[model samples]
Target: MSPVRRRALVVTLPFALAWAVVLAVFTGLRDRLPDPLATHFGPGGEADGFTGPGAFLSVASAVLIGSGLLIALGVLRTRTALRAQRPVVAIGYGTAGLLGYAFASVLFANADAVRASRVSEPVWQLGVAFGVACATGALGWLIAGRDTAPEDDPEGSAAPARLPLADGEVATWTRTVGSPVLLFGGVVAVLVGAVLAAVGPGVQAWLIVIGLISAAPARCRVTVDRRGLTVAPWFAPWPRKRIPLARIERATSGAANALSLGGWGYRITGRGSALVFRSGDALFLRLATGREFAVTVDDAATAAALLNALIERERGTSEQRG
Candidate 1:
């Protein structure tokens, strides 16, 4: 009934059940294999290059189960430190070390076999290797990338505390638009051609006019106020979305990765919604209307805390009114 016990049960019980199920299935399948298949891999068959179905299953199970066990063990070993609220730096280092070892083991064991295998074309092989490397590298980075501890800032103090403002008021946010030369030139050419066409006409002039119109610059803007948020991309018309603080459900902070949430721009994931930009820190907002708003901002943790506080205030007001 303690927090640690509750956390341990939540984390370990399902994992243990999953492992048991996996082991049961594996054992059942192995037991059902015909004698011939089981015996196909004779003594030292792994090194002898006798890779039959049984051998494949054995190797697959070892890799899968071994990796899972390693991860579980790591988590268990670090659980105490994590509960003690240790800095993330140590956890990241430990994670990176474990993943690095796992990746190295896989590469050393089968690199040659993978290179010689004809099941996949060279391009496919390269793609698989590249994908694995990228995954491993990303995991390593996430675990060991940056230390989040604030040296000067005291613990429990608001990180870069928000500047004082009028009660119940929000500050405006602004983003500057880039001047696109190509777009401006095209628009000017088209307008000139249109004017000329009204006086005198030619096919070349019409073509020029069309080209100019098509080359117009895209419009983009970033707007923020006391109520909520708004952002418009250049190529498409901006949606009239203004999320009031009263309607926000929750706000959470997470990493910005394309694989995790598709390619950044205005993605709707199963968890909620997000309007992600290509770069910078991201804040995910779950709204009461079942929409999610993903925003890129300078200080994400502060923003999330502020938003959460605002939502709590709104709820308090509603309850009081009722």
Candidate 2:
């Protein structure tokens, strides 16, 4: 089976089915449930917080569906080594089991409660949830079996993008790139926080903080010179990431989506690591360790070409010495 479809089947189906069953049971007990369901528990297990049934259902759906899609799509998009794919598949099943057990436990605890405050949960049930999660995760791992690793570029190596450079010639290319989507999301979050302030000041405060952080665009200066590639934040250049020319197998340019690269910021995925801040043109580096590193930026083609030329020059100098 194709790896993408295999991962989708192994993860998505179980996750969807688990949530579907939980929702179904919750609906079946609607008549028995109070208008406001007990959503939180005290130390002694008495209910401490409440939420409207409709609102609770809405939040549940959003969490389940949103997270499930992200997981499924993430697995499908990136190519993975067999070793990395194993844990990803297992975690997928375990997550579904954990979420399903927790949600269903709440419904059963709140069943037929005269008042939200009177609801109680046997804390032991939390242990059961973990047990169930472990079993399901193990099953997923077993089902994953042994899959072959993904294939790389043909011709035994990537054909590096090149720009002609003469002896002693030096070139440096730099660009500052930022994510508009992050800015948009931050604005929306702040607006939502304002609305939530009426309900709970404590929660609204955190939401506002998160919105501010998200809204602030992150800019990085991408530089390619004889020293290879360097990425430094616009705010501070002291802390920067660099890829040495000796470790780079090849450099190329391609269009990369932020989500497919595992969202904004430095993230590790089954395929490789990425410095994702936006979704657009990106410089792709295949390293000697068989892992790829990518940086999203404008004018990536120029940067990639410069890197290829520099790497070739370094190789020629090394060959003559040998």
Candidate 3:
């Protein structure tokens, strides 16, 4: 089978199997387990909080199934089959092992306990779960294997473009782009956080933090000049990403989806680093170090042409000096 298909399975199968095992084990432990299992423990490892079997299992399934599907989607949807794999695989297996062991331990802890209050969790089991996670993580990394460098990715070509420039003449290109998706997501996250604070988990504060960070820069400025490309949030003077002319090998414009570079925002995949506020037309740069940089923006063609022209001008001046 194709490697991409294999990678999807490699990352996704572990979570499914883990969830299945949990279900099977729980079924066998029905009579032995307390009706309301002691799901939470105190610092001393004594049972402090209780939950029904259905509720505990639901939470476990959500954690395992939801995360697995998300990672699988990321792996399957990336533009290149040569995308980074080791980290992705490691995270998948590590999460599966950690949660799997924790869930299993909880079930075993409640086993034969006549009542929830009588059950006690072994604090040492947390350490053991981490150890198992680390070992399984290594296994996943081995399974994912090596991947080709970004320079070898077959997604698209980087044919250089040139803007005719007279001697002593210079040009610059600039544009501001915004992502509605980011703006919407930020607002929703904050609202959800607020609602959750009133009705659900106390982790709502994190959601608010994420929302603020995401909403702060839905719009960013993309500039291409003799200095090379610079990207900065609209509200900040300090640019988030910058690529100097000396480091760039060439510039090109291409149709690229932000997701292809791996989930939005600034992402570094096996293909390259990208500042993707949104997806669509983008300016691409192949660096002197054999790495790539990309940013989604309108008028990307103009930005790419200007960058390429400036590169040629620099090369000509260097050759004359030599």
Output the number of the TM-score-best candidate. Answer: 3
lDDT top scorer = 3
Question: What is the alpha-carbon RMSD of candidate 3 to the true structure?
Answer: 4.4
lDDT of 3 by residue, 1-322 (tens): 6656666777888899889988988999987888899987766788866789999999999989988987777666554443345655776799899999999899999999989998998789989999989988887877766544342232254467689999999788899999886787789889978866665333357898898778777889888888888888888966468889989988888776554555566677775787777757888888999988888898788888888889989999999999
Report the poorest 10 consecutive residues by lDDT, candidate 2. 151-160
lDDT of 2 by residue, 1-322 (tens): 8877776666687678777978997889999999799876655676766889988887777767776886777666655433445566677778888888888888888898888888998888878999989988888777765556563321123345798999998788888877666777788789988876655424456777888777554667889999999998677774688999999988888776565565677768665788888766788888999988988888888888888899999999999999
Models sorted by TM-score, best on top = 3, 2, 1
Which regions of candidate 2 fall more than 4 Å away from where they truly are? 1-10, 42-46, 70-91, 122-158, 179-219, 254-264, 270-272, 277-281, 288-291, 314-322
Give all TM-scores, in the order shown.
Answer: 0.33, 0.71, 0.74
Error of 1 at 12 (Å): 35
Off by over 4 Å in 3: 1-6, 40-50, 114-120, 146-156, 166-170, 175-219, 255-264, 268-272, 276-282, 296-299, 317-322
Write down the lDDT of every candidate, Cα atoms only. Answer: 0.44, 0.76, 0.79
The per-prediction tally of clashing pairs is 3, 0, 0
Q: Candidate 3: deviation at residue 77, Å?
A: 3.2
Query: Which residue pairs in model 2 clash with each other?
Result: none
